[model samples]
Target chain A: MNKKWMSITVSLVLVFTLLATACSNKEKNSGGSTAKEGGKGEQVTITHYTIDSPDRTFVEKLIPDFEAKHPNIKVKVTKAPYEQFDSKLQSSIAAKNAPDVTSHWGYGGFMEYYNKEMLLDLTPYLDGFSGSDYNIPEDVMNIYKVDGKTYGIPLNSYVTVMLYNKDLFDKAGLSYPPTDYEDKSWTFDKMVEYAQKMTVDSKNLEEAQYGVDFGFGERDQRPQYFGAHVYSDDTWSNGGKPSEINLTKLEVVDAYKTIYGLIYDKKISPTPAFSQTVSGQYGDPFLSGKIGMSVVGSWSLAAAADFSFNVGVAAVPYNPNGDVRSVLYVDPLFVLKDSKHPKEAMEWIKYLITTEIQEKSIELSGGNPPVNQAAAEKYYNNFEGIEPKGIQQVFDGAYKYGFESYNHLISNYSQINELFINELAGVENGDKQVENVLPDIEKKLKDLLARVNK
Target chain B: MREAALKESANEVRRMRKWKLSQIIGFVILLLVTITMLSPVWFMVTTSLKTTKEMLVFPPTLIPKVFAWGNFSELFTNTDIKFGQQYRNSLIVSIFTVIGTIISSSFVAFGFARYQARSSSFLFMLVLSTLMLPYPAIMIPQFLLFMNLGLHDSLLPLILPSFFGSAYMIFLLKQFFSTLPDELYNAGRIDGCSEFRLYWNLTLPLAGPALATVAIFSFIWSWNDLLTPVLYLDSQENFTLPVGMAAMLSSKFRLAPWNLLMAASILSVLPIMLLFAVAQKRFVEGIVLTGIK
Candidate 1:
């Protein structure tokens, strides 16, 4: 080779080697984490993967206390932004390098973890362990059981409730919606009647006050409330393996049409387009105080903290003939199957649920209710800007009649939901008739289910 | 003679008037376009200074009703976020990335431009083919590879990849370098200068614009990158700017402090804007000279 060619090759190799060595040196210093002197029994550093939220913040704050209590086990909290958190966890699990402990919001996810057999069944832990921290409610405990095996514990929950503007109700001279779920007078039709009274005719979405904002496009949870099924129960039973879309069924169509009518015909609820105009950065129209009532989850309580008027919590309007089902969001924390230190991870999960910690969960998290009954009781009673009795009734109402939507229970739900969420938008926005679109939605949904089920 | 002179002066005056009028119109049109383009940046600046409550107000106020000076302070002082540390981390990674990418890509580009071998075309095609490998397809394998190297949680995974040379940058720099005369390299070799010296002393000084372009693009890409940092860095202390900024937004499930997010965004953008301002001349020249979009 020519001298120039030889010299060039040597320099390139040297440069790369120099950079790679520098990086390795840096990595060496960062990775050589010696046994934390304060810890006992050869300090074990366990990574805790959590999504960014009050829950993650709650975990981060407890890290020091956890480490101090269990000196042998070092707790390292890793919070990926919510968008990346699940994907990263899945990647780590696939790589067999999953974090020792992690959590997910079960209403939208975490079922996949169970379905894929990625979670460590916590039943064995519950059997061998004895502690007051594990005093979760019987119903909640039943939820954790997958084929009689305890899978996880719910750390926090977001129960669906009716967030009403008391000021609007009073201005219209209407009585507050009954907080007691048992009140037969407080029917679905009755709530709509009250809404019609308060809805002021306006020039546009900005000037006009919407009587209700039922979060139509966010997810049409209306079918569950109407005692209607969008799909057969067998589909949910089969974990969505042989699902059928019943969106064209009379009862299901009625449920969807009722909400659709509310936006276009009745003109009480805000249209998806209307809400877009009024929603600020948070996309919350209810917080603007222009709406009479909003049927949404309790997670919205944090956003309502700064409301200019009084807010009331009430049991969501229910179908008297149908089952009184409300969307109950249970966010659980579980140990990964691949966790190297399952015992240490279990220790961390248990410590987070002690009465002291659970009680502070509501206070620290701003608004997310703890699944622990005591802390949850405190959260429902005397919530920010809400009537204590009304909020309690609503909380009780959800617990008594709460059922997770089939979407939450099924595997491949994200994929299934993606298929029709956009196609169903035209019906949701009132531009297309429900009768005309249901057939197409069913076809597309079936296609997706067939593809995903295999 | 006197009449002709007067007529010439009048014509000159008319010509100047026409020229001045069009210039005024062009200036006005460009000013409007610039303002139209920068409105989002302006909104970010204004929103960063507004309270979260005020930011939500429709018909958003161009000027915040109340100046929230606290948003900037809160970005650093907020117990949960380590914006200051992240800012420093981003700088460290981006600077090293620029240095590594410029050196490696240029060296590789020089070989392709000036050197020849029987396998040269085949090897160049091989490098180019790597650009076709989608990130999603290879991300898992690359992540596993890094995990085995014990580099997963460190900033090394983020910076190490750039040193091996990137296909796009090498391609861009090669196009620019091939235009330079072979005589310069030959003369340097005739004087007994080694290949390293020729690259350093003779070729590099002339390739400043292309290198600056690569430097700018690499810095911006590294600075703005969210995926690598999110995948690699687990600890908050090592997070880059984009990851740190995203963490501030919270998520859809909860209330995001947009005011605080906007403030962090403005702060993060300062370095890039300053870079563009400083290297404005060369960056434009590099893109034009390299003929690479």
Candidate 2:
């Protein structure tokens, strides 16, 4: 009887709790879909969707300024986590409730939307707007044009660079890697030498301090640094068509051997397991100060905001064959054609690239170089240890010799990368040699690429 | 005779010692299990209190060099995270789900078990077949249905379905209801109780343990459900704890703030822990009474 009474009491309590919440739920439900337009001069809420990035929070800070400038527009922003961003964006667009403005991952995403006719041609929205004010070069803007229709505006430029822990280099008594992109003295071998000196290996991986992490430079982007072209440059210019792949090249094979030897033979770099073990609980190993030099994209510069070590950004080391190549990535701002307020979305995107916003991006986004060459020249001044001249050289070398990365411009890139990574996993795991694995993947890679491109 | 009595006394003492030894061994074994079970919980609590820098060091410090009490404090004050709002959202959704599941599942189970018909058994089997359908198979059509009704990006989609009864809960409950003797209802009928009154007054009160078991399961499922909210919710203000926490540590372009995530996680799980602690006895009885493996 006591148990029965207790059960009845619990059920009664749950009923009361439900009643209380139902009332509040009614209040929230009544205020649903706040995006409706009001009077001629009344508030119009425009939804902006963005992914988690160094720029995410920085953009959040600037949103208030944007809202302040346009009193009639209330900008409601939703930031998806990095992994969920694509799925969320696709779903939102499919539901015909696409955000007014969003950060397009790269050229490929913009082109994908273009082929689907999902993008709003911002060319009409630009009208008399001068691209120069925001450091948007006409040539760069023209790069996004398809038959005289412009769908995207350059958000920022992310160039691959070597981010070294200056404190670790000093402790190891090695001179810092040159920030001068033109320096002939810095090479892959020189980097490995410096790396070997700093590496302190232990049977217990958690205690080991790695000398370097190539940060996917050792993956598909391998050919980029080695001056080997696997795909035709015309792929993007031809509306993201299938590109014939040629990975049997001597340079391509050598690039794989070089990166893998660093992991297996030299053992100076962290293996895949090392990174996962450390990164699962801790953040990035480089930020943990366990890594000496991490050759990665410029976006990693955002680590300086919280990183304890003195960090510096330098140009990538040249290949032993006297070739130099830096991978360049450009994030674009795209508004959907289905957006309720296209004009308002344009205003918000334009605000993201202003001199003030771009400059603050360095502080907030950590390392996003404003496409404005002048701003890019002064990008490193925002950080404590990074010198202005050195950072300028990093940008200069990129513009001089670097090509736009093919991943963002090609169709079925993420899929191609995934398949490539799966094939390359054994090499990284010390099971297979690059010479053996690279040959086998060429057909599989081409097939996957063709399947998606078609 | 005195010597014989002494031998018997010695035998009794040895027997007592052997019993005491087994008890000691049992205690040690249980202690080992307890420590093993609590290890991850200990790690979470410690990690929450450590600074991000300290947490990242290799061969990670078992004891933090610096105890960052600020991690928990930051969860409340950070403008980016609306912890209070999300907590309220989770609580409301979970509680309502429990109430709805308990009432609806029991009602359906009663009808299936008590009222017999030519097709009643077949219908129960049909209901059980729904348990085999994977959620992803139905996710799209359901999403489309909810979206058309303008319930997308709202709590309604998360709470409304609970009122219809879950197939798994219904099945567990049907089996439980079948065990109740028919004579109870027959006896109540003889005492002038209506069919509804028998269901309401007699069966429901006796169905306490089974109902409690279902309520607990529904509450936990709703509380920890990330997919429902992640799919349905758009605004941060509408997010529940699971979705909000996932957003914070979502390893995308941004690095996860592990310390803050741990702190929020510890705080987020307290209610579930408390619920279990408060209702543990009845919950165990629920499982035992239902004879569910």
Over B144-169, each residue of candidate 2 has an lDDT whose tens digit, in order, gives 67777766667878887888889888
Chain A TM-scores for all candidates read 0.88, 0.85
lDDT of 1 by residue, B257-277 (tens): 778889998899899999999
Each candidate's interface RMSD? 4.2, 4.4
* Residues forming the 10-long window of minimal summed lDDT in candidate 2 chain A: A24-33
Across A1-454, the per-residue lDDT of candidate 2 in tens digits comes to 6567668758876775675455335423211124555676556667777654335645767778888898777776776665566666666666666777776552235566676677888888887776787767676777567878878888788777788888889999998888787687887788889999999887676568889888743256667676665666577578766566667888788777777888888989887777777776434668768799987777677556567678888878877564545767777778877887777778877777778777777667656678765566557676566787787788778666665665656555666667787998898888998888887888898777666666
C-alpha RMSD for every candidate: 4.2, 4.0
User: Which parts of model 1 are misplaced by more than 4 Å?
Assistant: A1-43, A106-108, A128-135, A170-174, A197-205, A216-220, A240-242, A280-282, A429-431, B1-31
Residue pairs clashing, model 2: A82-B252, A108-A408
- State which candidate has the highest DockQ: 1
Task: After the best TM-score superposition of candidate 1, give how far the Cα of residue B68 lies from its true spot, in angstroms.
Answer: 1.5
Top candidate, metric lDDT: 1
User: Which 10 consecutive positions of candidate 1 chain B have the poorest summed lDDT?
Assistant: B247-256
